[model samples]
Target: MARSKGQTALNRAQIVETGLRLLNEVGLDGLTLRRVAKELNVQAPALYWHVGNKQELLDEMATAMLREMSGGQGSDPPGSNWQELLAQAGRGLRRALLRYRDGAKVFAGTRLTDTGHAEEQEAHLRRLVAAGFSPDAAARASFIVFVFTEGFVIEQQAVHPMPGERAPGYDVTERAEALGPEFPLAAQAGADLFGDYDARFEEGLSAVIAGIGATLGPRTQS
Candidate 1:
């Protein structure tokens, strides 16, 4: 497959941007290098110059999403404590993952293509260390918060799927009814479990941060 005539103008950034736009339209399953190439009006072979395969493209897209979340800079505001920094990072990450359809899925397992995230992580870990967490503890604490945020968004997307759209079978009333009268507590819990995502996320994040502080804080160290 020969390169497209305009392939010279194509770059990795443009490919990633186009891939992200198409992701919202067709979703991760539907997105493909060929589809992206078509959107960019370039030959499929042209994309290989920037991304060798679909996974590579997805990795790039994921990295781009993170960059957008951080605004291409360290996100910590001045004077923020470690807990505040972790919470802010969690909230910012959730917002970023919610921006595109299946954004969480896109970001979950892919490797980033650049070092920008490394810089942010280094700063985050350093802050945690300065706050008296051992390096290993800091890494674990940060990872716990990160995974909590990622998992929350994954489930949120599963329930909502798309803006103004609720996936079938998640209706609180119907869910409660299906559980029947025998399971009163489980049925009643459906409403809280399935709805109030924003509040639930904040509550969950707070708990995670608190748990880290309790277990990994300076005072907890032996």
Candidate 2:
């Protein structure tokens, strides 16, 4: 239930964080404004002044999480060049989201669509443009990366037990059992698909960046 710096005692970020704590304990289905308020030792109405209703609280929590992913202003410190900076920024964002329990789910839900996360997108867009992309292309590519990463995170956390839910989780091999042997790849790689999300994420991201890099290769004089 940590609060943001420079925010009030009953700030939006604090309320959002309280919500996240509730999510961890009671889960999204069981989460409610009252539950969060009770945890924070405040009246629900007091939380409303800052965080609004449950849906808004969820979105704001997502925003707070994304900003936290952005880290301290200089945390992603620019490396030797824009390439390094872009990759470092990307890696920082990726690592931040991966650190929390259900980190991807929290981030994937309302984080990017919210206004606060737009700043992070804009910063990446600026870096991409400097790295030789047009504004539109940079923006598009960055969005793709965000979407892909979020989806990956959520899928990875799906096995997590929520309140009142029974799960140490199911077997991935259950699905593998259904596939026919003609699917040569599934016979070998099904486990890999359901497993090694971190490696899969990096592989996908590397492919994305490589494509972008190739597109912008070797600028020439007109």
Best by TM-score: 1
Q: Cα RMSD to native, each candidate?
A: 2.3, 6.0
lDDT of candidate 1 over 72-180, digit per residue (tens)? 4455788888889788889889989999999999999999888877777888899889888899998999889889999998999889877787878899999888999
Off by over 4 Å in 1: 1-8, 72-75, 220-222
Candidate 1: residue 45 lDDT (0-100):
89
Segments of candidate 2 deviating more than 4 angstroms = 1-11, 72-86, 109-123, 160-170, 173-187, 214-222
Question: In model 2, how large is the Cα lDDT of residue 106?
Answer: 60
Q: How do all models score by TM-score?
A: 0.90, 0.72
**Window of ten residues with lowest summed lDDT in model 2:** 160-169
Overall local distance difference test of candidate 1: 0.89
Best of the candidates, lDDT:
1
User: At residue 59, what lDDT does model 1 achieve?
Assistant: 97
Count residue pairs with overlapping backbones in model 2.
Answer: 0
